[model samples]
Target: MNRQAQAAVMFLLGAALLHAGATDLYLRYVKAGLQPLLLASGAVLIAAALATAWYERKRTRAAKAASASASASGTGAGHTHPEPRISWLLLLPLLSLILIAPPALGSYSALRAGTALQKPYALGTLPAGDPVPLSVVDYASRAAYGQGRSLHGRSVRVTGFLALDRTGTPYLVRMALNCCAADAQPVKIALAGKLPPVLQPDAWLEVTGTYSPKATHDPVNGGPIPYLSVTSAKPVPTPHDPYDETWNN
Candidate 1:
């Protein structure tokens, strides 16, 4: 790749980053908190690319003038500096971003990480609301450590991707991000009952269910994972924000 090609790559990358930041796509990979930073970085990168292009153009013009003067003075411009070639490998990531910006992490990642019981929260009482809408993290915490005692008689709606293990055990998994996808952690909620056979792993679903008191709680270290008794499972499109932001802190 010549200087122009290298500059073009930089410009494309910067534009891609900016596009990701400006759209809902960035939320798929990272928290909304980083949007401003991403936008700033993209803008800076584009500006830097523009500046570099300008500098290179100016330098090339100067080199031509110098070479012309030297040639006129009866001396050949000592071999012009060779243009550098950028490796083609640099295009892979940019192509990936352009062609297929991957969706948020799914069952493959969730299964690899497995699921852990949530730590106990000291909230004296569960938050007020009927059919209390809660994050998988919150539901897991209350179910595991609180022994479903707090969630008793409460109808709740939990949304996440459906993941099934080799044993055919189904789980609703949601990833929580602290800063970015790099620090993402999976929170899994086991779902009971026969789900639609057509539903493949990583299929997003909104499960309205109640916590089973039968779920064994390991208070020692919150070891035993919890389960939910699914009342109704409905297919839903991927959420605008796929991650559970409750645990982002």
Candidate 2:
């Protein structure tokens, strides 16, 4: 492609990066912490593209003037370059980002995962709330490794999408991201009591339950899978940032 097209592509790509960083669209692909880096990268790309375009235009004008003077003197002008056209393909991802943004990963990954997220470093005493709220990752950590000492008496509330095992046993599940979706691990707590009728697959829900000492082995990795005795449950809208960053935390 010509220099002009290269500049245009760079500008579009930088704009896309800036847009993603400036808004929640980026949360679908990366953590909140990377926003600053994205914005910086976008600015650099846009500046470089603009500078390239300006220089190319000035050089083109100078070349034209030189060629005109050469023709007036009856001398030949310099030859132009003929670069490959494959560079035009660089526009595909930019167009995809603009027109058809990809959706975040959901239950399809969680249910088939080889294992859940690793246990947190340390779990403190359950906080003071009638139904104490916790991330699914935190609850799983408390339930499995810490022996539910903090969870025994207090009712707990957590939110995540619904998934079922091969035997149709329901679970409250969330995808735990260490970095991005590519490295996401499932954080699941089995639901052992009555739930909302016809719980749709991958539907987000808020569940209030009591932690049960009884546990099951992970079907894939043979680790402890904690149980939550469902006392109350409700369907909820999907969260803006669907990942549980507690793993990163």
Candidate 3:
């Protein structure tokens, strides 16, 4: 195919990938680190298309002029014209991406995982209130402040997969990661209230209650840590590519 046509196809594909990466559906369902790569690739494809188009146009113009002049001189009538060099267009996209580096996934993703924010917690049984979803970051941040002492008695809903302990009850849960599953930290929560009937590994759940601090020694980190006391619990489906909790990109 001609350089112009090839470039056009590449540009279209690049645009489509870029659009998908920018959307929430792709961010949620697709891999987390892929968005930036897509964006970078798209930019490169676009640049390549533009360069190819320009080069082809110039070559065509030059070829046409040469043909016209040769035909006028009656010396090019039996001569065959050589194909234009279009390979240089291939470097356009690559050069564009190299020039403008895309941003990499960073701590913002972890913070968005819901472990960074501080929330108020209630003492004893939590009073009936509206349900609010709390992320791991939120629970962790509040617990970091020494639990219920600082929360001032507020209820929150937490959701994640059920990570069962040896006792069959899900005492700890973790957010699955596609890129860094091993680094997944357990969202420490206390399930003292009504617990779910059947605990499924990696089963999603929505828990609502005031943050009542529980004295639990961290087994992994080897330290004393606070856990959220769940008031209500229900099963939920695990999200596709659940690792990317934040849609900052």
In the range 1-249, model 2's lDDT, one tens digit per residue, is 888889989998999999999988888878777789989999999999999999999999998999999999999877978988887788888999878767777777777885565767787777787899899989888888888888888898899999877788888888877777678788788888869988788999999999888888778778668898889999999898888888644
Q: Candidate 3's error at 180, in angstroms?
A: 11
TM-score of 1: 0.85
Best candidate according to lDDT: 2
Q: Can you tell me which runs of candidate 3 are displaced by over 4 Å?
A: 1-9, 29-48, 60-133, 165-192, 215-225, 237-249
Question: In TM-score terms, which candidate is top?
Answer: 2
After the best TM-score superposition of candidate 3, give how far the Cα of residue 162 lies from its true spot, in angstroms. 2.4
**Number of clashes recorded per candidate:** 0, 0, 14
- As a whole number from 0 to 100, the lDDT of residue 162 in candidate 1 is 88
Candidate 1: list runs displaced more than 4 Å. 81-86, 116-125, 193-199, 216-223
lDDT of 1 by residue, 148-214 (tens): 8888989899899988777787888898887888878788887886466676899999888888865
Task: Give the Cα lDDT of each candidate.
Answer: 0.80, 0.85, 0.56
Name the 10 consecutive residues with the lowest summed lDDT in model 2. 114-123
Cα error, candidate 1, residue 110 (Å): 1.7
Give all TM-scores, in the order shown: 0.85, 0.94, 0.53
